[model samples]
Target: MIKLPTISTYYGGKGSSGTYQKIINHVRPHDTLIIPFLGNCALTRRIQWPAQVIANDLDPYIIDQWRNAELGPRLDLYNLPALDFLATVLKRPNLGRVVIYCDPPYPLGSRKSQQLRYHFEMTDRDHEELLTAIRFLRVDCLVSTYPNERYAQQLSHWNRTEFQSQTRHGAATEWLFYNYPIPEVLHDTRFAGNNYREREYIKRKAARWVAKWALLPPHEQQHIMEQLIIVTPNVIVNQINN
Candidate 1:
């Protein structure tokens, strides 16, 4: 897994994690990464060209957006059920070094709560089916999820990392499991969101945002920087200095 450049830039709707940048960075420009379940597609938009991304989801709305996006050769849009589409990609001849980076629907913890939360829903069986396929396929993959017993047992050999990212209530824990060993640069992410490292976090985050500003598309770049209490690079500097 080759590490691409790091950036503070992030996107996607609710429940989205910024750690995908680590997964995306590892994808080599020459290889193909299949996005089986493209949600709001923070990863799809962030990917710079020369590296090809096949972005697909069951949602027609998502497909339409992708089709209209003038991303040039960097992205290909499709609307297909994830499992069938994944099967199709794998069967293709001459497909070299393919990586599947996906975020699927979370398991139905509460039918009542989940029904209101997400349009699409998943079950334990669905999770099992996907895991079964992945286990036999012999491919490199990264999947994100909450901790589950089935996953721990099935993917025991795979590398795992615990991540902390912001969510509505406060902080949330998410797990990233990869089929191959991830390098330290990709795995050892320390986000100082606490009061203890407040000054240091801002300084580091400022630098990260700076690195990504030029590379990211203007709209995405804007969204990422907008919610920040500290806005521009110059302002970030001012806050640190003050």
Candidate 2:
């Protein structure tokens, strides 16, 4: 199979189906498919393999959207948490070679009150739980996550490989997780590269600073920085003294 690009035009992109189809071609005909987090079901709908798929998510609205869709795999969008979904998958007797594609929320420290955010941050403990869930499956599995040191360490236990691609906005690094061994030849396939110009633009935009006081020791730094924006004299002069 060919190497698929990782980047998407949007978070839930339309080209995901093509990527899913490539993945399906690698697996056997009667394997069971389990997708834990169904954002838009674009990928699930595109997979044409004749396998039993159990697509689910904790988001009720997303599940509702999947339920109302005219096409896609037969999904059971559960309202339960991720652990609950894993338990349900474990209890299934027809646990053949299972393929799981998960895109859990990348919870950095910046996301404070997002509705879809998870409580426990992405740490080694959470990574262990994720890996344990992946191991629980009786069949082959594939997982995806944003590139981070913690996630990289977690994925090291699996047949890990990296894919880089560019979206319209910028570049992205995606790691693919597989339980069983894959050949070396499949690993060398060339995928698309990220647009460096766009990436640089975003980097520059995100490089603004609050103040050195904000960067002081955590205990010494004031808590108001979260609610207030500290401006330099140049900024103040530009606005008032001009």
Q: Rate the local accuracy (lDDT) of all candidates.
A: 0.61, 0.52
Clash count, candidate 1: 0
On lDDT, the candidate that comes out on top is 1
How large an RMSD does model 1 have? Answer: 12.7
Stretches of candidate 2 exceeding 4 Å from the true structure: 1-30, 70-73, 107-128, 135-137, 183-242
Candidate 2: tens digits of C-alpha lDDT, residues 1-242: 31222323225343531344334333332356677766654456555433466777676766666566533444455666666787787688866645666656553522233343432235456556876666545566677655666656656767766664343335555565666666322211122113445545645554544355556787655444433435454433333321
Q: Can you write out model 1's per-residue Cα lDDT over 140-173, one digit (the tens) per residue?
A: 7877766778778887888887766565445556
Q: Against the correct fold, how does model 1 do in TM-score?
A: 0.64
| Position 98, candidate 1: lDDT | 68
- Global CA lDDT computed for model 2: 0.52
